[model samples]
Target chain A: MRMPSPKQTLAKAEMDMTPMIDMTFQLIAFFMVLLNFAETEQDARIKLPSSELAKPPEVALESPLVLQLTKDDKVIFGGELLPISGLGQPLSREKRFLELNGVDPKEATIVIRADGDAKTGVVQEVMQLCQENDFEIFALRAKQELAEEEP
Target chain B: MKLRNTGELSDKVDIQMTPMIDIVFLLLIFFIFNFRIVVQEGDFNIRMPVAGPSAASIDTQLPIRVRLTSDDEGNLTGIVAGDRKLDNFSDLHQFILAQVGNDAGPDGADNMEVELDCDYGLKYRYVISAVTAISGYVTADGHIVKLIQKIKLSPPKKPS
Candidate 1:
């Protein structure tokens, strides 16, 4: 038996990275396809109130009860203006209504999506209502980049 | 027999990429499922305040949340403590302090927790004023008060 020279040995020791590159490209494509853009746009009109102690919510869960506050202090939920002077009673009533309809109130977190120019009174009114409704988990929606400057 | 040596070589090489492709696909799926893309929108322009490192964790013993709202003129308008509405910030802060001072906890310090809910579009100065007022109430009498420690600032909720 004759042994191959150093040049032949070097040629046989080459590693082919084509498979690895292909796999990487495939993964990138998969992530790009599964991204959800609709949820990203839903809160586009919500300008969250800032705070020194505010932190981005730990986890993003589905089925959040979103409350949109307009500049005129009109509260819109599910594309309809809620007809209540204050947020407390109406929200409690709505949560009860959801529970009556077989929805779990505890599983639903409240997302306060307020217009930047909306009055603070309106926001508080809603928050006060949410508290009465037993909604403890609250998430204030804001741009991710802007959230970094919150604290 | 006449044999000649040639230096020609093919550029293509066959390599098994099934396992590598499978791993890449798995990673791509993981990120795709975990990636959260958030796009925020709202009418209010808010500049949130920052604080130096203070005590960690929320004081949940006497959690009394206060919400402040400003009118179109940027003046403090409404105040809410828990589910009750107060006339103004002064009243709200005084009420909170009174409650905290009365409660007897460990070390004789009040264990009241205060959470502030402010409007997004309200002037930062107004929020600061409210916060200052609340802080003052917590540290009154110069007796080394330590009841209320954590101050949580939250966004105001829209009325439903």
Candidate 2:
């Protein structure tokens, strides 16, 4: 009698990629949620002077001392006119008042908002007085669109 | 058991994956779709002066600032200190130095701080000149010198 024919072998294999695909999608979602574009737009119009040691200001929006300089050389503080000279005395007094009321002076920052047409002389004068008053942290206001213009 | 199964084989087997090919492709797609590339430029059309960092951090109490502007003929104009009108660089520098020298805080801190707000249309050379003059006000003895920080270059705004 002829020997039984060799049995044909059957091969069966399958891969389940559901776990890997799920992990990939999760990673994609993480990056999408954390990106920020508003920071680039916040100071577009303000042209900050370049310095090797210059750094971004550390002040927040609520407690900063806001100073605005107009093209006509008018100095506005929190929407009020500030005398061009001897501003340090009054500002220091204000700081003292804040401290008395429980605000920390070191946590306070001065914000400078100036027009492009403002003169260099005026800017220098303001800077000098701020230095005298001992205000350490400062923020320069600019439009966000302007920052994007740099290469 | 009718006829014994002579040729039957197992019907299921598991295969291991290549492990990282598809993950990389998905990552590449995610970045390409979500990335934001931007080039920033200021709306103010002014050139700014350069300066080194001050030796000391300014005091937080006194918030003195100077505002600079130019007339149609490019003549500098603005308030220097103490509400006085300033037309030239010499007066500006002297006023700054004096203000800083005499600054006395409640805690007896003599720290000084300054901000420069310059007009956008002004020339770069003029801005530099002003910065140079201001630097001289920082006394060499270190007793009268304070920090000059925050130079703002922007366009003039209309009064409200």
**Which one wins on DockQ?**
1
- Where is the poorest 10-residue window by lDDT in model 1 chain B? B41-50
Residue-level lDDT tens digits of model 1 in B66-109: 77776656666787878888886567667766776677776323
Highest TM-score: give the candidate number.
1
Question: Per-residue alpha-carbon lDDT of model 2 for B25-85, expressed as tens digits?
Answer: 6675867575664433222111122233443433244435666675655555564544677
Per-residue CA lDDT of candidate 2, range A30-121, in tens?
Answer: 66665555543323333343321222334334456766666666677644566676467777886887688787655566666665456545
TM-score of each: 0.41, 0.33
TM-score of chain B of 1: 0.49
Q: How high a TM-score does candidate 1 get?
A: 0.41
* iRMSD for each candidate structure, in the order shown: 10.7, 11.4
Could you give candidate 1's per-residue lDDT for residues A33-79 as a string of tens digits?
76665564364445544332233445565447778877677777767
